[model samples]
Target: MNKIQQFWSDFCIVTHKEGIEYKDAFQFGTSADWLADLVVEGKKTATTSGYMFYEFENEAIPQTGEYYIVLNGLEEPVAVIQIQSVEVIPMNEVTEEFALAEGEGDYQFWWNAHEKFFTELLKEYDKEFSPNMLVVCERFKKVYSK
Candidate 1:
């Protein structure tokens, strides 16, 4: 197995041995390595993504109480986080409080960055950017780190 595969294998073994339940594995931003570091440091506690992307990718919405293995930019396992809550809201409805939970920067910065990120992603599907686009807002707490 490759290094990434081995990491997950080891993690599964350890978690199972300790009787911890994990639901799935995923990485942070496409190129944002710092965000993963923030998660490891227990700074970033929430994330948001385009709801359509999840549908397009055929991925399940994260559930409360589900444990997720967080990977870094290098696709290396960095930390484990448990989902606390998930809400689906329009992009324009995203609030300052939720932006603060992202731990990237101030509210405006988060808004701008996420808008750009989602805009680009939607382009692949020939979708136009819409201020009212649906987004999945997930709140999580770090449970373990490497």
Candidate 2:
């Protein structure tokens, strides 16, 4: 089996969730190594992404109670997370507390970083970033890690 499959199998076995048949593994924006490190250290607990990206890719919006395996830049599974909450709101509407949960820095840092990231990502698709654009805000708990 590939590394992600093996990691998922082992995680299920240890967590007593073998009956679950769904597995969604992904890395954080651009890559996953730095974000994975933050997560492993319990510094990062939440993230936000532009809703247009999901619609552009024809992917379903993230929902609460879903579980996902967090992969690193090398594509190795490093952590498992369970979604605790989900909110779809305007990018400019995010609360300071939620931004802080991202563990990147303070509210201003989060705002500046996200604005820039979204702007660049949208550009690649010939789209434009707007402060009023919808963003999927997710809060998750680290359930298991290796």
Candidate 3:
């Protein structure tokens, strides 16, 4: 089996969960090494994404209770996580507690970094950034990691 399939097999055996398939598998950010490290260290438990990006890619909104495989920079599976919560709110409406859960520093840091990152991502698609734009905030639990 490939790495991810083997990882999934191992996870099933260890967790004794049946009839559950991962909803998605992906890296946290453009570069996942540092973020993956944070996750492995139990620092990052939440993430945010622009709603427009999801629309741009025609992807469904993340739902709670869904499992996912977290990948690193090398596109190798590193951890398994389950979505604890998902919310769609305006970017300006994000809470300090939620930002802190992201493990990226304080709210100011989260705002500055996310604004910059989303600004660039929107620009690439000829979309404009707005504070009122929708943001998908997802909180997940690191069930297993290496």
How far in Å is the alpha carbon of 28 misplaced in model 1?
1.0
lDDT of each: 0.85, 0.90, 0.91
Deviation from native of the Cα of residue 112 in model 3, angstroms: 1.0
1 or 3: which has the higher TM-score?
3
Tens digits of per-residue lDDT, candidate 1, 17-85, equal: 355556766788865579889998888999999999889999888989988888887777888788999
Residue lDDT tens for model 3, 1-146: 89998888788888998667998789997669888888888999999999988899999999999999999999899899999999999999999999999998999999999999999999999988899999999999999875
Please give each candidate's TM-score: 0.87, 0.95, 0.96
Error of 3 at 96 (Å): 0.9
Using lDDT as the measure, what is the rank order of every candidate, best first?
A: 3, 2, 1
- By lDDT, the better pick of 1 and 2 is 2
Give per-model CA RMSD. Answer: 2.3, 1.1, 1.0
Sliding window of 10 residues with minimal summed lDDT for model 3: 11-20
What are the runs in model 2 whose C-alpha is more than 4 Å off?
none
Candidate 3: count of backbone clashes, pairs at least 3 residues apart or interchain: 0
